[model samples]
Target: MLRARRWSTRLFNLQRQGRMGTTAPIDGEEAAVVGSAAAMDPAVDWAVPQYREPVGLSRFGDRVLLHTILYHLGHPDAGAYPPDIHVFPTQISIAAQIPHAVGLAWGLRLRGEPGAVLCYFGDGATSEGDFYEAANLAGVVRAPVILLCVNNSWAISTPVRLQTAAGSIADKAAAAGIPGVRVDGNDVVAVREATAAARRRALAGEGPTLIEAVTYRMGPHTTADDPTRYVPPEELAAWAERDPIARLGTRLEQAGLWDDDRQRAAEEDADRRFDAAFDAAQATPLRDDVFIDTAYASPTPQLERQRRLLHDERSRGAG
Candidate 1:
């Protein structure tokens, strides 16, 4: 969690410095992401995450971070993950990954693969039709999937009250004929246990589980958002008292398992790792015909002509 937080902070800083594109900060919801990811056996289980999660998904693979950096760098290869990674590329379309997760899990079952799919999305995604369709299908097919909905109180400028009238996001799981669990997202242990139970159910062929992790977004929804306009100052302050990283650090300190020196070391290591990845991403060559190359299996005559035209224009400009 410490490393994840530091990486997130560094990414945000990069965006501010105009070194990267728009990025989401995993500020207050670290536990909800890292804890749930920790419960999965990366060797077997797969992760499908929305855009905000790559930082916390180090539990799955370090390649996730490298790929994310490449993605922000506008590298075409960012869309591809190595065959063994067991993680899908980051989804920016709201709630779209939910159905993809369900499909992957169902396909795994059909192929007799022994693994479940862990899908992560935010509360804003719940409003999308994709969430409902995917959840219902998962129930009907008994897909080995876990739908983790991180309810961080606000969706962009929209608050929870405006997002839904249901008592809680977890309650929505009932329509899908699955168990709904609401866990204190600030507590890492509780989040881990909830996800573990959900994973057990999934692997046992019981079905999918919908987990609502109640937490707060202490920062803007993204680098482009201004939460101060909608998120009350007092509300942010109150949630600050329950910061997931600090809460876990305090518990670990009491157990004699953590200290300031260890925390500093973790932060420093994270900085070094991110810097190296950033440099690697920068060094990667950008493909000039990436659009034509990735858009089709074989380019049509019209596309071929356009590609040549583009190259000719570039060549003339260079000369």
Candidate 2:
């Protein structure tokens, strides 16, 4: 999990350096993401990730190229192939991908596929109309999907207390006629167990289940947001005590599964990998006329004119 944090932190730093766009930090949420991802078979399971789900995407072999495509908001469909995994371009509009995941599961079910779709979202997304709508459809049709909510206790500037009056986001799933379970999001082992069970049930056509991994967002919502304004220092310190990566490392140490030397080596390895990936991403050639390129199959008259202008500029060495 510390390795996961290393990757997330490196990516977060890259975003700050203008090498990438705004990114949702998963520094504290690594356990929830990695544990859940580890429970499934990457060869079969599908992950419909939000912007913050790099842990899952990385576990599924998503590489720097995936991040490159995501940063540019480039079309991933053309590049999404076996073992590369799937991640929806970070959704600024909350809860938008819920229905899309449902549709994917519905199609998979129609084809009699034995796999589950894991949809990641935040606690704030529960308030959106689409969240309930999609959950209802999944429940009614018994779609092979798991609704996983990483309740990090904040939505940008909004605290979770103000986001909902309910005790937990998992409870909302009850209204949609689905089972809901709350687990220790910081406990990677527990999360893996719960998600594995949920996946089994989903593949059996039992119905959609909502698993709320109760955790906290240790970092600011983004590089642009200041968490100190709304979050008290004491609360932050308390959450820090329960830091997911630290907890996992401690547990592994106790079990003799890891040691300080191993931890340091892992951190160093992750840092080197991230540095190489960043360099590669920076060296990648950007499409010269992407701004004027028509992404659609059929270009409109306006797009055609823009393309011609770009071509003329290139020919005249004015680009």
* Clash statistics: count for each candidate: 0, 0
Candidate 1 weakest ten by summed lDDT: 70-79
List ranges where model 1 is wrong by over 4 Å.
316-319
What RMSD does model 2 have?
A: 2.7
Best model per TM-score: 1
lDDT (Cα, tens digit) per residue for candidate 1, span 185-234: 99999999999999999999999999999999999989899887888899
| Cα lDDT listed for each candidate | 0.92, 0.79
What is candidate 1's TM-score against the reference?
A: 0.97
